[model samples]
Target: MKIRTIVFLTLFTCGSLALLVGSWLQVIPFTLTEDLGFITGALSVWLTVVENIWNFPIGIANDIFFFVLFWQAGLFADMGLQVLYVLLGLQGWYLWLHGGKNKTSLRVSNISPLELLVLVLITGIATTSLTFYLQTLQDSAPFWDALTTVLSLVAQYMLNKKFVENWYGWILADLIYIPLYIYERLYLTGVVYVTFLVMCLFGIRAWLQSRRAYA
Candidate 1:
């Protein structure tokens, strides 16, 4: 890694640890698990923006943290989504290392129009079905939760394949998540989603530049 990247990661880790400590001590209003999820989630997105392979491992940790947090909050769909994220993260880790032409490192690329259409259709169907299922369980914000869940799944899959369009899906989901988290009284998590919304823009720009460089 470059010196600057190393310095950034070190500072980010230290800052996250400080937040975790503060939350644990009740100096911060968020729960320990929430703080952990926020730290890992934010760091993972930042690393993804830079196309860092470390994002996958950090993201898996983030998924586990959020799974516990969401389960406690009764966001069942979101809780289930975290399990899928862990699976996707592991796949992404390998693909980033070698899922390319002849076992080479993957390169950023665009999705085809047909693929985009298919993903949209799939997301819509999944969200509708999940929303109904969550409603049966009396979940709060069932539709919104299902929408974000499906969108995130598609985005993560696209990201695993190094598709430049993944950021768009993430941006959409984050926008929905911001208000949803706040509505659930997960204020810190809402703030994290707001940060995610910004990081996703950078991800789009960075990945586009990477794709152009490859070309």
Candidate 2:
């Protein structure tokens, strides 16, 4: 079978399943159509398969919808990160389209040593600061919220450069978020991230293969 055929089948299957779950959960307050978040999620996953730059647009849409939901849910950290994601998405689109030193830098590349170190350090300091501050603001589970927020910021920055490390960040955050969403009765979101977890694993493998091709 062609690789294209398999990819389409996988996306279709996942998307259809998410639709079913969304219908059952009725998680969104006023919609019977495909949940915007789930739809964008499936689009983002599909875009990852082709390494398309258009994932940024889908991600932006996903972030907006989620911003509203998270704000209402009082997941303040996640809510704030969704806004950051919009900015990050725009940055990623710009970078992907024109980030090359000579305006041609879209090739698959591994994370550089210096960049990785900086990313880790930034994540640590930002997470610590956000957690401490939010705790003072009486946010529930400030530490966990900060952890997800920091990881997501790191992931978004990496994504702007088309880095595969983005998936690793996403995987960790999704793992933490699945239970949190379930506890909050955000059943559709819980299921969405569960699917996102599986896709992140696939995305890592796919990006690694592309990295090897570049090598």
TM-score of each: 0.95, 0.85
How badly does each model clash, as a count of residue pairs?
0, 0
Model 1 compared with the native: what TM-score?
A: 0.95
- The RMSD of every model to the true structure, in order and in angstroms, is 1.3, 3.3
Residue-wise C-alpha lDDT for candidate 2, range 4-55, written one tens digit per residue: 7688868777866766676668753433232677678767876865688888
Tens-place lDDT per residue, model 1, 41-123, is 99999989998899999999999999999999999999999999999999999999999999999999999999999999999
Query: What range of 10 consecutive residues in model 2 has the weakest lDDT sum?
Result: 27-36
Candidate 1 clashing pairs, residues 3+ apart or interchain: none
Candidate number with greatest TM-score = 1
